[model samples]
Target: MVGILLQPQSSPFPLLFLAAVSPPLLPALGVFSLIIILMAVTIGDRLIVRGMNRFRVWLTPWFKSQPSPWLELSWSLLQWGLRLGLWLLGVIGVLLLPASNPLQRWLLLTFTPVVNRLTSLLVTPLFTLGKATITLTSLFTLIVVSLALLLLSRWLRNWIKQRVLTRLGLDRGNQEAIAGVIGYLFTALGIIIVLQTIGIDLSSLAVLAGVLGIGLGFAFQQLASNFISGLTLLVEQPIKVGDFIEVDGLLGTVEKISIRSTVLRTNDNLCVIVPNNRFLERNVVNWSYANPQSRIHLPIGVAFGSDTVLVTEALLAAARQDARVLSHPAPSVWFKRFGDSAYEFELLVWIDEPKDFEPIKSSLNFLVEQELSYRGIEIPFPQRELRVRHTEELRLLFNQPTSPAPTSPQRPSQPPIPPPQAVQSSFSAPGQFAQDQTLRVLLRKVAYFANCSDAELRVLIERGYQKFFRSGQVIFRANQPGDTFYIILSGSVEVLSEGQWSPNQAETPPLAVSIDPKATFIQVENQVLATLSKGDFFGEISLLTGAPRSATVRAVEDTILFVVDRNALQKLLQEYQELAERIAIELAQRQQVLRELGLLNQEDESNPADKTPLQRIRQRLQTLFSLSDRPGWPGHA
Candidate 1:
């Protein structure tokens, strides 16, 4: 390497010093100062970041109601574009320095040869064709042009859909279709023009295109099919947005149809993304297609000998009473068949909104029951006449001493239902049948509910809901609303009266001044009368009368319970007609106990002498559930 002789003649200052300070030295300083000032203004407090944030804030409100993908893309482009412009300005500043300056010389020396070599390599042809030659520059140009076109296509598509088509008042599907078609046209034409501008002959690329096409055909076959299907959906408009449809056994409203997939919002508020092709391939049920009216079937069964005419009239009245049931179609009743233990009929009512079907059916059930009860038509359970040829096993199960054969060989005419044995077992109160089985199975096994059919039991299950309670959660407090009742399905609960004060906790009253630690404290809590576990059921009597509860029930641990509210309880009582009186008697006794213990709320003070608890409860039940009227009982004046 040879050392260059000092050129003091070129500049008054040393060449190295001149290089460090840069050239046209006085002017260079001024330019650098200007650049420094710009950089300081741009970088201080992160000017770029703050500007972006301010832009986002300003743009947010304009598109607050709906998201804008085009805005997001444009914002990204602006950010990158600003950075590129700043960098270009910096490079121009450096290149503007005097050539004799070492800094400028060094930069030129380092990059000029590489730049020249690269230009030669990139501009030279990699392959020559009859009409065009392919070079690195052309390939690079194609890639960059494709990317630019991609962005342009997206931006245009979104603009047309959101700005142009929307103003035309066209439907969303039509808007999407138009936008997509425009986008495809732009993309196709853009690629053709770019290829021709770059001197790439379309004819020369045919064989290569064919090979690529075969490979791409296999790779994106489903993608292409789904895209085509999406286009067809937008054009045909078989299932429009907001139309309720069932496809692939999934029921929902159409949310959006994109290029490849369609979105559906289900009744549960879940968004399901289904491929567009599925709509074309599978059978779709559009309930809200043209006519918004649809018929719903409510099956009714009553005691075998009930009058069909009254049944029909009751059903018709129930249907007409509800505003939701359309009158134009006219509700019709069809006698389906003679059920094993009852007459099976279907109540067909036309409804306008299928989405409200569940609620409509539920309300109609209450009305139907009211109408049937008004006419005293019993909706009886399927009576399974038990033929016990041998009573020995049942007798042993009840732990009864084997009794001698019945005197005089009495004919068993639907042997009178046995009373539930008053459970004297310490597990329950003095006279209560301990619920030791599940609600459904208990209904089947218990003697009081023996008349209930499987269908009626199923109704009980459908009506009640299961609830979970953490340890120490109070299920019900004494004197709270007694409309709800609980049946322990998987855990234990404590039943306490309103009640004996057990000293389980203590708290001192705060004084005017700081209280001493030794201050006297008093605490009184409910006495835990009993701990009842799984299969335990309570609150039936309280639900019947809607009276104040006489006891508090608390969960002993993490527990699951089947809870039935007033309406369901009323229905259950109505189905088990014979058990209602017994439940009333039980409630009366519990109320007496509460009164004696001085736990009764003053609001609950009653003249017990005028009406027996049983009579009061029955009358209350009649008013609450529209049960059949019965003749005066023993205490009814």
Candidate 2:
């Protein structure tokens, strides 16, 4: 080959060929080659430096007085320069190939010439304006498209979050996760399109994709499972936000659901994070799943001797009366078990909503206590009886007579009974009657006597007698003629009606009402009105009835009573007709109020009602005063 090249040709073909192609191409090709190298070095360095600077400046704020616009401009310039430089380098690299490489040379000659012509045609007009109009137009278009895309993405996200997810009742956590997923999907598509526009080939991506898939599968198995589970949860909706659930013994309200986990806020203000897969595997109690008609089971126990029927009725009444309790499915009481000292009963009541369960349960407990107390059903405490050998001293101390002994003459010589004037003055002194003000105040508080003046109340107190009785002491007997009304001052008293009465048989025997000091007990005819306590009063009703006692009263403990004699009341009525009339009216009004309040039983009585002397006088006054044409009494009219 070397010898053939050294030998001279007979024809002039080599020289002619050199002259035709080589001379025209040498300078142009050399100039193009140098331009290519210069552009590559300069543009490539500019792009790399600009990109690094933009990133550094964007990420670090320490060097800038004002940074936001600078950072954005720098980033935009970096992206534009990098893309433009890459295009220029590609065109230059193609043009630099030698003519010996026929395929590459032809391609460059054909396509590069057309590309250069188009570039010259496009660039000449833009440069004639003395500005980078093309670059500016491109940047503006990019900015506008970016802004439009950003706004469109934001609007779409908001629509999905509010209109879509909210309608589905998805939590914010789930909404954010879904929005992120959508953004990532759109970003991936945008990147592929951008790569294609930059003349990058994706034909080689299949192998890369296979490798990525295998790597991702190995690295993110749990993540993949959770993501799939989250999609399933969204589709199936096994549990939702705001659901009260019990999972693995953790009872709480579901606060959020995300791709990886679910968050629950417990009743005690604890936040519990449960894995999505774990939630799918565990058993959950959804309190509000089908309906929020939650049933409350209240367990009540009463003393062994209590009347179960009465207890059941009272409990049912209590449940019915409560507004929170549902009425359609009526309340039920079952005798649960017999315990050591009490009969246990379960009171089952239904509520309309799950959220109301706690409040209803609370109100029911309060009502149960009140009802049991009012009906005299004993709620026994845990108690044990201990037997002990009693010594003589113990017996003597316990059995000692509680009543005060009379003053003995041997102790001190007593003065003659003081004159009525001295007695009255001594009793009315501030020191002598200071403690009596409490009793005076208590008497005024009695609802039946609330209308009485302070002076009249004091007179009543002055006339009242204090009596004490030990436990088991009989204050009065059943069927005995009612002589006087007794007010309990301290301790408790039991009311016993004759066992022969059928209605009374169903009621627990010897119904006791606790009577602390300052309580008044009244002996009324034909009815056991009430067993009174401190700040309680009675016996005005007795003035309405002129018959004998209906039930016996016995002291359940050491009890003190403030008793108002019937005869004293009769005298007081005679002296003050106006006061008596006012008292009578007050009593009647109180009874009417009690009946309206549902505190008194609704029943008809067979006994004949008697008109008090004050009532009759009031009738005469009304007749005399006569506002109507018929001159009828006020009540009679």
Tens digit of per-residue lDDT, candidate 1, span 546-578? 667777888889998776677766676677665
lDDT tens digits, residue span 1-637, model 2: 3222222223232243234334455554556664565466555645555565566554453321233353445445545455556555544453445633554566577789898877676444332112223333444455555554543454465566666877888665466557645754665576556445433356656666787989999899888888777666655667766677778987778776666778888867888988778667778777867565778899999998886656775587578668777754557677899987789999988886664566788899989987776666778987788876868878889988898878876766678998988886675332222233245556656554566665555455444556678887987776555546765567877665543322323442244443233434433223454566654544434333333455667777888776766555654555545565565455445545434433233452222375543344345333422223222223554
Candidate 2: deviation at residue 216, Å? 5.5
What value does the lDDT take at residue 437 in candidate 2? 29
Give the count of colliding residue pairs in each prediction. 0, 12
Model 2: residue 367 alpha-carbon error in angstroms: 2.1
**Predicted structure 2: lDDT:** 0.59
Q: Candidate 2 clash total?
A: 12
lDDT of each: 0.69, 0.59
Candidate 2: misplaced stretches above 4 Å?
A: 1-222, 267-272, 385-637
Question: Using alpha carbons, what is the TM-score of model 1?
Answer: 0.50
